[model samples]
Target: MTDTRRGSIQRLDNIAVVVDDFEAAKAFFGELGLELEGEATVAGDSVDRLIGLTGVRSDIAMMRTPDGHARLELTKYHSPSPLAGDPQAPPNVLGAHRVMFAVKDIDDIVERLRPHGAELLGEVVQHENSYRLCYLRGPAGILVALAEQLG
Candidate 1:
């Protein structure tokens, strides 16, 4: 092996998730603890340069973390077909997955989401590392995960 050293890695920057309704997804994530940072529009030119798209109108919502380091970017395209099959299923076939957030009160957060039409995909289970997590589907099948860090 080469005797070379690299600089230390820093904290996570951000992750992006595609949504059906920008406003609804923003509200859903806000209820889970993240705060809406702002929104942006990506014109067709930008989209084409990014992914060979002729035109694209997307609404982007930037959610800030409490610590102000990592962020969750939610993007909703104005024109796109709905996801097929069971939307609740993991997007393994499509190469996408849900983002899991660690929280202090997972149960309480899940309770708060009940009234807003959020549904749990599985029962919350306690793990060995003093953790508990539950899968949830938000508005428009937006996959979400709520986890409590007891350790």
Candidate 2:
């Protein structure tokens, strides 16, 4: 009898986020301390077909954490344009609402991002001795949560 087991799945490649402004989104995530990995512009029918959009042209920027375990793909659509949505939508509204990160100093990171217009969704709070966390609203209404682990 032949074996019918499937191959093991690989690690996550990256998380993609659609944004309105390319440079602003890059700067926002950069301020949060994620290193910029690379960037490129993609277009033509091949890209459109791959993304299931018509005549899609976009600029993509990839950012990875210093540890290099996680990554984010930021895309700014130029052709066909991006549609507007509720920027103030709550976390429970559904869809991909936020991305969380483990940081060494959450407070300091938050302070640094404040000048770039990042607003805390709520005050930073500690959950017993597990973690200290807070969510910040970044450019294009992207929500980012930072958690500092307690020793």
Candidate 3:
């Protein structure tokens, strides 16, 4: 592990994505090789106040990568209905753009995700001899990127 510097952040715990279908989102990430960590319903005064919302109740599915280095949290709001946003917005749009994952076979992973409504934002392209990459819009129109390293 790298030495921690004073005033420096330690590490990223997880990335959260709000979805409309809890099951579908779980399955989508499952197909991409993320193992289910657990499921839970979060609510109560603390959660509501933390998110700046009242009466917040949501179902969450936590999935971690096979290496256990990355985690993705999928949420489905039950109370104080989730706000609307442009999930289908192009990559150029602002805000949290996309989440990228490294893969062994980009084609195989792409084929598997297609059955779960994964739509390619652009054709898989090779970058020099370093990696092959592509971006796809997954459930909830979330943009996901896949990279396959090449030797």
Per candidate, the number of residue pairs that clash is 0, 0, 0
**Whole-model lDDT, model 2:** 0.89
Query: What order do you get sorting by lDDT, best first?
Result: 3, 2, 1
Q: For model 2, what is the alpha-carbon lDDT of residue 137?
A: 89
Q: Pick the candidate with the highest TM-score.
A: 3
Candidate number with greatest lDDT: 3
List the pairs of residues colliding in candidate 1: none
Q: Which stretches of candidate 1 lie over 4 Å from their true place?
A: 1-11, 80-86, 91-94
TM-score of 1: 0.81
Candidate 2 residue-wise lDDT, 28-84, digit = tens: 899888999999999998887887989888899999989999999998988888998
Task: Encode model 1's per-residue lDDT on 12-90: one tens digit a residue.
Answer: 7788877776777788888877888888987667676786566667778899978787799998777443345456666
TM-score of each: 0.81, 0.93, 0.94
The CA lDDT at 105 in model 3 is 93
Q: After superposition, how far is residue 45 of candidate 2 from its true place, in Å?
A: 1.4
